[model samples]
Target: MFTPQGPTLRELAAQALSSVEHGYDLLAPKFDHTPFRTPDSVLDAVGGALRPMGPFESGLDLCCGTGAGMDVLAMLCDESVTGVDISAGMLAVGRERLRADGPPSGIGERGPSVAWVRGDARALPFGPAFDLVVSFGAFGHFLPRELPGLFAQVHSVLRPGGRFVFPITAPPRPSSPWYWALLGFDAVMRVRNALWRPPFVMYYRAFRLGDVQRELAWAGFAVELRALPEFGYRRDGSPRCRMVVATRGGGATPV
Candidate 1:
């Protein structure tokens, strides 16, 4: 589902054939017009949930495609925010947007100074300089087996007591159309990766919340889940969307 300004079918096909980094580079300019961008509503909800817990001085947005998650960090963190991604094209677009939009308004005399760096999330290129870290719609690019190292990387970049936060939706029931759609998408991706080189790893069904929580804990995070009331609850009375707040403690050991 894309708007008229979004990438054409031909462009998308070309992107699919490229490596994940290159594919995102090709898609970066029109990304915000596509369904792939994290929705403003989701970002707002996460901001609201984190507001009470912060006044954080420094924040980082992991896998920050076009810097959407940085908006949330700017609202919560007063000092500075940094966005890191593997795509130089995405970072280029993000830099242009920042220059045009300027600093976000209403956060005192100035909002946080923002910077974009090209770096992989698996090995973030910074010290424990951040009090907060956030990611949006990027975890699907990481395989299930990479969860441990990924979480460890996030933990390593966070100051003690700092949080690695992100929103996750509850999986659809087996009977739901969405469930089948995601299942099919993952199956197709698996087949494509098997047949192709420089695999474009984007599997909708692979990033389960339970597995993620376990990995976060293993990475020495004191994990907590907070329900996003804006999304409401499911028929089973469980939250339809929840924010995972994994805090790095003193015991965190980098891999």
Candidate 2:
């Protein structure tokens, strides 16, 4: 899944041995070349799904590694877009990508301004200053127990009725090969953490939709699910991908 520009096997081993923050810092330079980066297709799908609900003002991209989600924010938000990450290296690369790529398509000549901040997702450094927040492909770094705190942080950063949106894929069935693959991946990660110092937390199976929905509600969000038609549905007739729109209640804002 990794391209030639991606990290070497030895380099990846070194990163796997480091702490999560430091590991991402080391991998930041070649991250987009790796399969770890969120696919453009997913980004486009989310952006399309959110367009009708948006026209949002200020937006935040929580755990915004390499600022992939910021592109979507630029398309949806009118004023400004901020990307927060724990890794300085990742933020630096994100800034470079912004500079090189310029504004995303569909944004006007006076597109939303962009900024990068280095901060943990559990304790964001902003007030309730954002109208919307979006994240992509960064949840696995957080353990299952951290969901409440993480969702709370997102809630705290958003204005009342503002949305905290992210796309989640339906879990693979027990009969599917992907199910066993992810199960084995999580098992390996558990063993690695058991044996190593400064754990690099990345598990594929830990973030379940039921658990996440409950945590979002506890964190004070009225949650809704929107199917992304682009990815289609499973043979079981469930959506392959759905966007979770968690609105911090109290106001009547449509989104």
Candidate 3:
């Protein structure tokens, strides 16, 4: 699951015992080495899917954990890119990485000017300022009940006609070993959360694609799902993964 540089079992146990912010802070330095970091392949696939919708002016990466989505935003947005997260330690690590190999500091030089802001996704610090917003691999941290507020926050931050995009893979078939693995994982998390204080909230099965699309619609966004060809199709011929592109609009669109 983790590289040698990633957190050890004891370290992971310690993190799980702490609050979500604190757990992430403790794991921030070694986050990219862990499986929890969004894979570069998914980011590349999403970048390809977004290329047609862009040449966007400004972009935001909500709940960016170590800033992987910023690279995608830089490729699509011409003006500026901002990554927001709740963990200051994670932001600090991201800042160090950006300073090491980030885009040009000057806006409109070569790539988009990038900035990292520490804040919560539920109550964003910005207004309708971004033309494109992307999030990767962070939804599992948010419970099902929190979907409406989270969707509303994303809707509020995006400029009129702007897009809110994210990649969501199909749930594993019940017959597959992966399905039982995830079920066991979620069950263990539930037990842990029940017994633990300052609960470390994370679940693999809570963010259902159907429920998410409906919540996005209720939040005043026109939603569309685009199949990503990179992962190919499942046995049923449906896309293995789809990019949900929600646009801020007055009327609803097909999901």
Candidate 4:
């Protein structure tokens, strides 16, 4: 669902027909107003979960649309934080927001600084330079086939023992309305891609937990899932949401 400030139906239709990058570029200005943006609650939960693991030196926000994940990085990392996204329009909005917020201060001589980089997630233009990396609500942009390469790229950019953290909500059960809604969305997306140019590779049901864990392991990450207690549990007693923390294999790096 979208707000009055969000993209109109016609604008959304135009975006859907465009390439993923162009679609996001068109949607960038109004992205934060849409339900598609990562919610503040999820971000806060992630920040709280990551605080104990950090005091990290440098951080990266992968696929950082409008830099929402940068807030989590700022809380955990002491030195600097970089938000990377493919859309120039998104980066522009992110840069302006960060500038307005100013650098975060406290706990050290240098406060956390924010930088925006425009680039593809599959081919990140960075070395093993980051002590922590995080992405929020951006996984659907990559198809299942792309997960391996995407995780590998994140691994490449992280220092050994650095983490790639993100929160994942448990899939809705078959009886749930959310389940049918997502199924319908994926079905429509499939049809749209079949009949249109520049396919948008976003599918709600495609990113299975088992497959994702296996791919992360293959990409040299030791994975763990921490339950986000703020969201409570499902009827079966499983966590409603969990934060996936994948640390690159090796000894822990100094903060």
Q: Please list the C-alpha lDDT of all candidates, in the order they appear.
A: 0.91, 0.91, 0.89, 0.88
Candidates sorted by lDDT, best first: 2, 1, 3, 4
Clashing pairs in 4: none
Taking all chains together, each candidate's TM-score versus the true structure is: 0.97, 0.96, 0.95, 0.94
Question: lDDT tens string, model 3, 43-72?
Answer: 999998899877999999999878888888
Mind giving the per-residue lDDT tens digits that candidate 4 earns over 149-244? 999898888998889999989999999999999999999999999999889888999988899999998888999999999999998999999999
- Candidate 3, residue 28: the lDDT equals 96
Model 1 C-alpha lDDT per residue in residues 1-255, reported as the tens digit of each score: 799999999999999989999999999999989999999999999998899998899999999999888888888888888999999999999889877887665234677777889999988889989999999999999999999999988888888999999999999999999999999988998999999998999998889988998898889999999999999999989999999999989875756
Per TM-score, the best of the predicted structures is 1
lDDT (0-100) at residue 217 of candidate 1? 86
Q: Candidates 3 and 4: which is better by lDDT?
A: 3
Residue 5 Cα positional deviation in candidate 3, in Å, after optimal superposition: 0.9
TM-score of 2: 0.96
Candidate 3: give the clashing pairs: none
Q: Residue 154 deviation, candidate 2, in Å?
A: 0.6
Q: After superposition, how far is residue 69 of candidate 1 from its true place, in Å?
A: 0.6
Evaluate model 3: give its TM-score.
0.95
